[model samples]
Target chain A: MKDPLILVIEDEESIRGMLRMALEIAGFECIEADNIQSGHTMIANKRPDLVLLDWMLPGGNGIELLRRLKREDSTKELPVIMLTAKTTEDNMVQGLEVGADDYVTKPFAPRELIARIKALLRRSPGVLQDERMQVGKLILDGESKRIFLGQEILEMGPTEFNLLHFFISHPERAFTRGQLLDRVWGANVYVEERTVDVHIRRLRMALQSASLDYSSIIETVRGTGYRFSSRSVVPAAERFEASGMHSAHWQ
Target chain B: MKDPLILVIEDEESIRGMLRMALEIAGFECIEADNIQSGHTMIANKRPDLVLLDWMLPGGNGIELLRRLKREDSTKELPVIMLTAKTTEDNMVQGLEVGADDYVTKPFAPRELIARIKALLRRSPGVLQDERMQVGKLILDGESKRIFLGQEILEMGPTEFNLLHFFISHPERAFTRGQLLDRVWGANVYVEERTVDVHIRRLRMALQSASLDYSSIIETVRGTGYRFSSRSVVPAAERFEASGMHSAHWQ
Candidate 1:
């Protein structure tokens, strides 16, 4: 997918230029708004996917504009990151409380800012939101946020759910740990790559709990990460038929 | 840790009573304030870890109180999740724009509220805040938000940093995927258990990036999840000495 368009609302030409250069380098489309008046108009007219707002702009307090944007339904769900020179907890908390998804202090690293922007864009609704997708009997219902294996509900955490959902959506493609982390955990969020292994184990365990052997559909590429395979596997149910030994117990 | 105290600010007696029962059942201590005046005073005096705020109140709007709270440093960072009967997108947006952490509609499930509370509590800055901890040459400097391998800086994502930090904090103890999620990812956030593994791999990769042979510190428990070993291992630096090959390429 092409990078989402980012609206930059800042009074300072230098900072706005810096942001534009950084965002464009990250492959995102950018639109500039010099002050709150222009920012509001730009938002209403352009309807950018995400916004990078200045906390203090010429003519008005940047926060009031944020409140106005959030108070309206049309602009309410828009992901916004507040850029400010203020480092006080009062301002940071107020900005966040006022619905800013992220608050970055001025003179911030462009790399980190781009990373934060990407992360927020990914978290925005409808990006990862998808209707139910099925691989074998394992069903991921996105609307209700539930997973089902045939008649039984498969209990798993949100990370596992998203991971499974991502895998199932792109069935049969092998994803390395780095790609999975960026797609699943997000770029700004950090954790060990091995964490992927842990969540996968839990996913398989959930499948086991439902008394299903559909876990084999999520194949492990020997040297790399994992893949959700659409192809048929030697049915584990048939393989262990005589033992009647449940994989759930083993997990 | 003991369950954190939660203050429920609502005008309705029945809803407050329901909240009290649910919170008490979940082992959380509860306090209630029926009006904006009392709610403000209760927050100031009681200093609860989390607040369940009602949107509309008897004397004034509840969102005004939220704005006031967010506007102050003393009350700021005190997690507040809005409880509202109003299901309008405008109300939700305004409440959130005013800085309410999570907004829940009336007749909501108590279980979901508690989950959200736990998640928000875990996300609060101080809960996981700790001074730097060192395991060998690796240092997780909390204040600087940087990791150091000997004199070299280690680059990693926040999740990997936290996972490593958490592991280093409680070395040698095995923690299940559920425990890790609660402590590291926060409760409401979801992902697969195998995600833990993927993160671990990523963590090791980070260590490799620093040219460190410390990957052996994190060990996967046979039956459950993972553990960080504080004990000495036959240093791989010595084991593969003849090859003169760095582990970075292997990862």
Candidate 2:
């Protein structure tokens, strides 16, 4: 297989050369850009597998470049790892909030840099060559952008499908509305959190058509946000086995 | 720095010896246990930085071992990685479901194993060395498992504390009920899925005592699950944002 491509956007010639050499040694094809303009141009033309973005650039700053990449439909899904000198918590939050997949501080070890790249690549959806995702009776085909519940295809809007896609891929963590917005909506756009509610409702309705137990599957966290659980709604038989028939485990 | 202590629980003598040598080379102090009973005792006494558990054992399975570790208060925080020959889909889900922080299929390279060990340690609360988790005014002490809103301490149960701990540790990204159960409850217990709902309610009540805006913090996904967010619940924000926003941007 051909080596995965990496786009490095940095102004410093020395740093750029160093990163190119390191990535090349690690079996990645390198595309270097001296500034944000060239970076965007390369991004538009080359569409590299991943982008190693510098936080600061001459005209459009890295944050601005990140915003534009996330805004556009074609590039929104591209994985980005920010390379920055700013290691403060606030800057980290802003970088993450802006949709950078992961970040590394300047003066990082080459080994650490390579490890992060490999980890990010492994986690990216593009790395999974499988065109379909299947769990239990549910199936999601990335190629067709279709979902199948058992044998029957389930029809859902783009938003609901994307929501389901995220949930299925990373199951078992409660996500707040803000997080959903940041991930699903992209970091650049500002939107109402409640809109998450409308889309969630639509997604559930779509799942219901397959006769699945959508209610118990997507559990409400009351004051928290939402979680998708494959746990049975009924307390498992084991609970009864553990708690003697006399004392009530439920208060 | 003193080497981080690691407990290796496996039946095979050769594998155990190999792991012991490799871990020592990787700057970790090692403790060995052949059976589940002995492993539990070693865990109680040593309180190792991490547990490398073999999935198949002569006396008991690794899933059960993980369950017992997570149930107890003292050892519950310990990170575990399962080493196994079984690479089936069901096994992966089951291992993860049973609270194995990570799993490595057998015949694995030592480097990959060590990398995973280091990665888990880095993410672990104790190992991360970050004492507090704070989102806005809400603060959680990882070492003490205490919640403080401003200056006042918030009262909570072990389960609620764990729930809050997981939520704060991973902000954003909605988790479903099954995932929460596997994570917070550990994989072995068969409690009512709705029990998560009850605990969430109790947690909210505790947060309310501090007069913190806990209500808006945990958002209900209606049919999906729960998420903890810092976003405001104002309806006007939703109307204004949703009108022009793309459906994908809900979080």
Candidate 3:
């Protein structure tokens, strides 16, 4: 396969050089744009496989660029990661909410940045390998960002699909909202924790319409967190007579 | 260590005998209760490590038994798994919504039954060897069924406590509603999927009183499921500029 094309969008020459060098070393073909206009131009012309966007830029903001990318029919599905100097929680949330695929804070370890980049690329539908994930009757097609419950298609937003994809890939384990943001919303974002609840509500509502049995799939762990399990446990004493099973005795 | 005590509640003598024998082989001490009333009495007195409950009993239905157990302060913490012949999807939802820890269908293999029992026992707060699960400033005491946010005790219902406990124990993954019911609510229940949402709202409300950052801990994956994380990606992104650096590139 051809080397994955990576586009870097930033205003700092030094950082651009750094990213270009790192990405090239990591076996990706690198392209650089020094501002939003040039970035947009390059995106329109070059159509790189992935985009690395800096949150702050001259002429137009990084978020605006992201919105434009998402809004445009041609670029809506292109994966973009935000690079920002700000580490505040709200900014991270906003970036993710606006549809940035992932983000990285400034001064991050080169290895961590590379890993995030790779993960984002890997998660991009139909780009790399591992196209499908399943949990019980639920199936998520990463390539198409579609979900199937048995044979019927289940409709959901991008965020919900990503979240479900994450859960189906890893079952029987629980995750908190903060961790969810880190994994599903991406490592770099700033948003209110309550926002997770709103989205959860939305996701559930969508699933309910599909006639899929969503109850046994996502469990509330009470004051701790949430978990996914294939089967819920039966009370032991109740099990004996119902199943006509003999009880074990201990000395 | 002493063998874990398992209380078996069923009306059928032959089935009770089978469970007794099976549990003993699996290294558990068993106590038999032929009916719901007797089972409740034994639970109050014996405080067994786990309860194996039959859905249909002579005195009361298993659902009512679960409600009583969850309502009482002392027995509320006890983990209960339902045993039933019902294999329908609706039954599974109801069993979990009512607060059973897990469930096993009738005609289940002895090995499968034992495995489910062990998994539930391991997840029970006091029974398992792993006592505490910590993330950030939050601490979950599995033995006491308590949550401490930086030394302050956080009050929660049994369901919320279990949810939090599960999230802390298993981090960095997402869970769908169906999976949660199977793990947190147990199987063989017929409850509305909306019930999970109500419980989640209640759990969040309880956690809010403690000034704990519960919002960031549990995230909604929009169209898919819920997740728990230690960090809120959105909030963290706002602080990025403070790091004194920014990426420089365009696209």
TM-score of chain A of each: 0.55, 0.51, 0.52
User: Residue B44, candidate 2: how far off, in angstroms?
Assistant: 44
Per-candidate TM-score against the hidden true structure: 0.38, 0.31, 0.31
Model 1, span A18-78: residue lDDT tens = 5765575444779999999999999999889899999988879899999998999999999
- Ranked candidates, highest DockQ first: 3, 2, 1
Per TM-score, the best of the predicted structures is 1
Angstrom error at residue B168, model 1: 15
Model 3: per-residue Cα lDDT over B59-153, one tens digit each: 77987988788767777667788899888856655665556656778867877777667654543432233366555556676533456676466
Instruction: Categorize the docking of model 1.
Output: incorrect
Compared to the true structure, candidate 1 yields what TM-score?
0.38
- Every candidate's fraction of true contacts kept comes to 0.00, 0.00, 0.05
Please state the error at residue A165 of candidate 1 in Å.
15
Instruction: Give the Cα error of residue A131 in candidate 2, in Å.
Output: 3.0
Model 3 has a clash total of 144
Highest-lDDT candidate = 1
Better candidate number, 1 or 2, judged by lDDT: 1
Candidate 1: residue B102 Cα off by (Å): 1.9
lDDT of 2 by residue, A57-111 (tens): 8987898899888889999888898988777888678888989988998755555
Clash count of each predicted structure = 55, 37, 144
Worst 10 residues of 2 chain B by lDDT: B242-251
Off by over 4 Å in 2: A1-49, A52-130, A232-251, B1-251
